[model samples]
Target: MSTQTASSIEIEAFEPHPGWARQGRQPRIAIIGAGMSGIAAVVKLRRAGYTDLTVFEKADRVGGTWRENHYPGLSCDVPSYWYSFTFAKNPDWSHRFAYGPEIQAYMERTARDFGVLDVTHFDTPVTELRYEAPTWRLTTGRGDEHVFDVVISATGVLHHPAFPDIPGLDSFEGEAFHSARWNDDLDLAGKRVGIIGTGSTAAQIVGEIGPEVGRMSVFQRTPQWMAPLPQKAYSKAWKRFLRLFPFVQTLLYHFYYWYMTSRVGGAVLGDEKAHARLAEACRRNLAENVHDPELRARLTPDYKAACKRIVVASDFYPAICADNAELVTDAIERIEPGGVRTKDGRLHELDVLVLATGFDPTRFILPTKVTGENGVDLEKRWDDAPRAHRSMSVPGFPNLWMIEGPTGPVGNLSLITISEYQLGYVIQCLDKMKRDGLEAIAAREEAFDAYNAYLREGLKKTIWVTGGCHSWYIDKTGMPNLYPYAPQQFRKEMQRPDFSEYRLIHEV
Candidate 1:
């Protein structure tokens, strides 16, 4: 092993404007969720010389998605090197696409190494948040209460699992569970399996267990456009070299970010040439992989490639084409006691049923009753739709910052990179608070409305709206709950806070 460690890597500190020391005292910070974003927040805050912080995690461990999801073949689509923290780069990822366990290990190691695990209160969920002028009150699940000057909600979007609404689903005699809540004790060898939905999770599970299972019935409500995922193992020699010279790994990280995000960003934002190239790649991948015309037609999607979150898999096609696996396109009328009943009067029998129907993406900072200044309820305010100014601040919530909140960039880019950018932006806002000696800060109502209005218009050009497919990205308001701007533009916008759009408060 190299003598140099992640701590040896020099990280630049945020240089607050001159006269930043005019603030009276550092604020007590409470961070909800010990996920990747929450871990990033703690690291950045401490690096910026703010040590008064505590992290509340509902689980017994860190690594949110990676911790919760552990089904077969669960892996990140983003490259391993690029899907890591800039401060702590891993030189020994097993593959280009890191598996869920590997990613979870990375997260735990990062938290342990950076001292995040020490300050984090695992198994303590924040149930309520109430703004009391300059300070905020946080109530935990254990009936414990804490006061803080600032609260950061890093509660991720995809934490809650969403099961299918098929009738008689609960009546299934077989062992059934959502993909997120996988039953590790159950063995799958020679057992018949039935998977519902054709999203990424279902694709991954089918690809891994198709040959081993006696039979597999994949219930596809809609076919997904699969992009070719080329995974390569990192050689031991390369790993050693990366360990010796970490800067090379950093360079590779930036290169991957630029390469991956540029293609995805352009394609989703209605760039004609980029969209065409991406669509052709997906179509060609399907055509070349599945040769049978009947099977190919069943697997082909009616919508555009980037319309829904593109499923990335190298083994899914071949696994589905295997004799043991059958892709059922018939509409599922209801789940029966022993199997699934389709509208065609066919019953697909199974020993195990897995619902990979995905999560409720809109439940950010929910189940936590949050009351802002002057008796403003966050749930009621966003009854129509979830909206945040610049994806971080709400109009009524003062001294509250959200990382990867509503309207955040949700493209094919690595979420690690996006969360880092948002953390940097949040740090800048906090620094500004100190410089101004402000008691609290919130986004202006007009600014929040205008920013969402701009997002509504910008989404019109994106593939999510015009690509002729319904996706989870669209909110109840018939608008996309994502940032529609280019990746470069997002980075630029997050570099600093636009103070004019905020409502800064100070008491006499």
Candidate 2:
């Protein structure tokens, strides 16, 4: 974070969109998850004059992953300036990359400040969502059923833990937990810890506790593209300048936004030379951190860069190379009574086993039984792969818009920004519905097919599929789940909503 002075400018109040509020009769809206996306959905809906909004957050708190996953050294990879909501620009962020606790607090404050808590239902989990003609019936975990005119799915993809099914995992007597389901009570100051998976979560955990632990064994399946994190504390004076001068905050956001999109984003967009250059940089960083050539080779990836999620951390390389830490590249044979067995017949003992295995990205919305027209279950329909028109709606699912559907992992951009744009698209649809006196609306089947077709063609052009690597981004059917265009191009497409592409009707 730079300590330069910012020019003070006059700040103006933000106004609600024109005709955003309902006219004669308001529609009842229920938003499924109050995480970043759900919070964005509700915040935008409220600002648009949609007073009848209910945000259902399963956890007692407002933040999603930020609230649930209390893993050590938990911080966002994206810069703090770009990660926050555009409407609620936070100028007092302590670090360049805000950690989990501060971010959760920020979201909670935003909810309270925006009057979202008034209509939000905390500790309420929507068990099932059914669309009966014009209304959506949502059944909660408490057996309470509520009906709404529209159902917005803001439940994030990475909220659920995806544990690997190693043999004898259940028989392990040692204390074990997923990174998302971290046992806060379990102390690991001087205990032996075995963490499975070298993803971002485990990378962060290793950096935090590697120095403190007696012995640390890091299990790796595939090495991620690790990069340096330039995080620094912002001075009080700089924060004051940011707070006093809103334009400076805006400028900072833009700076990070363009910088990230150019480096990593360019690599994903089929730039193999860019990928090789980044790979060399990562190799150099690894070499500088780890003196042993063999250990460095184990840390390197055989696959190309930008194939999987790029993990950013300054201390990861050093953590793994710590005197007490061991990087195990061997494939897991099975789980023993007290430790894990590798293919090389090595039984690593451990007191606490942490599975940082990432979430089920393919599981679009699990455990939520969604029945649309003709009793077509959303879960059953999209079992193999999920699809949505403009990453929002389907042909059978009426008045239902899913944020961050299959068509978006939003490579190389802040997820909050992509989510805000997605919510903007959904809100436009809601505005059209209220203004046109529409009873129900669904994306035309032809439009859905056409969009996915375009997406399929674009995925083949990207490095995710062409590059020699497999991840949650690619579905079972070889369909990569990233937005099928450049970051800026996708934003341009989202800015304009074409109702002609959707089957907007007064009655279904």
Candidate 3:
């Protein structure tokens, strides 16, 4: 690939191969999710000469999470340099941490520029995915069924918003909604707002609404550890330099990746010194922003860093300290007509309610009905706790690959990197199938079980499992199905196709 600005590239329509028109022999692949990861898969596969492909997106547009979550103050915690796809780096990042709209626009542009949009089926959600004897069958929400030789589930975990099932949640007379599904019609000017669950979304929303609302009551179950974000607009000179010197840009990306991945390792497996330093920095950040001792104490996190995601914002603590905002640490008992009632029987009056609770990360590629061999449901097979070999292939699901699958990397590291790596692996598998005339490829049961056990053992030592905090990363059984501590080791394991770990059935 040449070193050019993402905007400079023009997308051309893909022409079908002569073999595609043949009576019975071309391989077809269906990719679910037209997000960054899914687009990456389509681009890579097309470049590798797999012409028969289709991308299905549930929404009318591309950019999965970015297209869905349009809440105020919504932005990526990761730096823009690392957050984007490596193959298509943007030299013109406005902020160090790009906002949702900008990121969404980038994805949309990527799809358009790469011709993935032409092949993508928008406003279509896959209702059912079944594996026939030799091909995978898919049913859309519109009651249309299609078959493919292989399937790739790039449908990410974060897109599905998980609302809390609190008592009397439905009876709240006030305008209440999840942060993912922000209600734009409800005006907050001079209106009291009760925000629930001070996670990343809650922090961002509170900061955004604090200056506008009459009074902002932020409800917190556990305080999040926030870091200072060095967010600033990039200069035109910086973009020029990045474009002129591609090597420098690569070096910069590597430096950021190494630094971030090292921090993840330090938090998950390194000595206590690193964790303590991070904790001290978090405390100093909180103390500097919040003047009141009570408020500072309420904002301090008790668990270890990386147990739950560490938020990055320069304004969140300061916003909470504002006169209009008040942080309530007490558990919410129920939703009264006017406001929320805490466990201590105190009714905090509010006009609007915002649930900033996070997404359902444990339920990987969920809500999409996927059936495998012999009409076996993928959900029932996993039993709500999905497992995958190298977070790619399931035991019984043949020729089905999942990018950013269960137990895949979740923290600090760039998801773009994980997606690229997974896509590469999937393409390689397809290449092998084409070369060897294989009909299907399924993970060996022993290898799948062993990989899951290894992942479980690694999670046992991490702060996400041992720490006294509950997060979306954990399943109902409390297993951490996100990232592992040794990301590099995992990457190396996925560098090539491990045929021994999988069962490859040749075409008869």
Candidate 4:
């Protein structure tokens, strides 16, 4: 039995079953996590008449990233109306941007309402997932094995913590933890705190805890685009109006999609006038919040706006300018028994060190071994540079689909929106398999390569590529790992499943 290349394999068409006229066989489906992607899959699957589905979540709780990262003042950067699922809406969001707890509760409630809670296998993580010819066999962390006809890789990026490899980091005398794994039992009241990495996470953490700490020393590598967040509690009258007029809420949701993609994304791509205009707005916002020239300069980003993720914080600038706060721009040399030592030959002493260091955004799947045809490992196949056709399927891997594949979340649009679009596309592919009695489906390598090449070509003019900042959106080669297109473009791309570029493998 010799193995075959994806292009060389031949898939024969089978005649329909006599009973097929009555009903089609529902494929056994397994979703990896219960996060937003997984939950979206479960909800949509059930709606599409897919009952044989199970969601395996490693954690005991339902909220994926939100449940993990509970640092000070954690919240969704996007508005709550736009950030929610298509099937559910929270009209009573206390603020425009929902906090971590509220987002987690929303996820929990969505799971409950969608009946995904009962189908979810809690505390069960897939230790190994491999494709066996026509089906996928998954092994749980508990050492149990199960087979499924289709597997959706929905365990998205941003879960794994990327800790800096500073010298003597392990020997830190004080309590140190990543913002993703925030320390709750240990109080930082009146304690000198040192926060590292001034990215999106760092901005929120600093704003939330700066007023309470005795002293805050923020170590920065590069400045990010900081914009003012008009975060405020909803007025009672407004909330009541939103609840009464549900269409108004729906309209608001669509408006955000347009605003973030067309308005914000257009500014970054070939719109020089708009780019300068938005940049001026951010600079003015920074000036109004931070009075000190030095502090304001330090807060200002040299990169173009929307290069890295723009930090939306109302208090982060003011927090850094506070008398008890000190922003350290020098490179970190090492960690000592007392605190961090910088290249400036100064030891920034601290009682607690908060690593606001963001996750390895490129690494979408961690700790999961995915093997495809001929025992080709997915990680080895990617070779540090991951690629997928339309951020969904790969060539060698059949009957497997990635929810938010490489460069999947490049656009500033809501990730939930992206997940559903991909879900809908994959479901159509699976339905074709069920209707046609096909055993395997793999994307053509030529198609995959073509899509990525087009993405790279388009990225050359975008802020993430041309802008001076090095963000997680790009790979080591400086080529973007994201799609580098507007949300509307992506939606248009996934609006239909093009089978011309795929190898539909029918069972012999």
TM-score of 3: 0.92
Residues 1-508, model 2: lDDT tens digits: 1011111211122222222223366677788887788878878887888767777778776887888888999999899999989999999999999999899889888877776666667767889988777778888886877777788898877777898989989988989889998898888988989999988898899999998889999999887878888899999999889878899999888998887787778788876777777777776777788889898878888887777877888888988988899999899999998799999999999999999998877666668889999999987888778788888887898889888776775666788998998888888888788778787779999988888888888888777877788887778787767785778888888897988898877755
Q: In model 4, how many backbone clashes occur?
A: 2
Question: Lowest-scoring 10 consecutive residues by lDDT in candidate 1?
Answer: 1-10
Per-model lDDT: 0.86, 0.81, 0.79, 0.82
Q: Could you give candidate 3's per-residue lDDT for residues 271-336 as a string of tens digits?
A: 476677776777788888888887887777788766788887788888888888888988889887
Error of 1 at 489 (Å): 0.6
lDDT winner among the candidates? Answer: 1
Identify the runs in model 1 with alpha carbons over 4 angstroms from their true place: 1-23
**Candidate 2 residue pairs that clash:** none
Candidate 1 per-residue lDDT over residues 16-66, each given as its tens digit: 222222456667788999899999989999999788888888888888888
Q: All predictions: root-mean-square deviation over Cα?
A: 5.2, 6.8, 4.6, 6.7
Candidate 4 residue lDDT tens string, 1-508:
1111222322222222322212466677889888899999998988888887877888886888988889988988888899989789788899988999889888888888777776777777888888877778888887877777788988887888999989989878999999999878988889999999988899999999999999999999898888788787998899899889999999999988877776666776767776787788788888788888887787778888888877888878889988999999999999999999998899999899999888876666657888999999988888868888888888998888989888775556788898999999988887777777677789999998888888889889888877788777788876687777766788888878899889988762
Better of 1 and 4 by TM-score: 1
Worst 10 residues of 2 by lDDT: 1-10
TM-score of 1: 0.95
Residue 379 lDDT in candidate 3: 87
Q: Which residues of candidate 3, in runs, are more than 4 Å off?
A: 1-26
How would the candidate models be sorted by lDDT, starting from the highest? Answer: 1, 4, 2, 3
Q: Candidate 3: worst 10 consecutive residues by lDDT?
A: 1-10
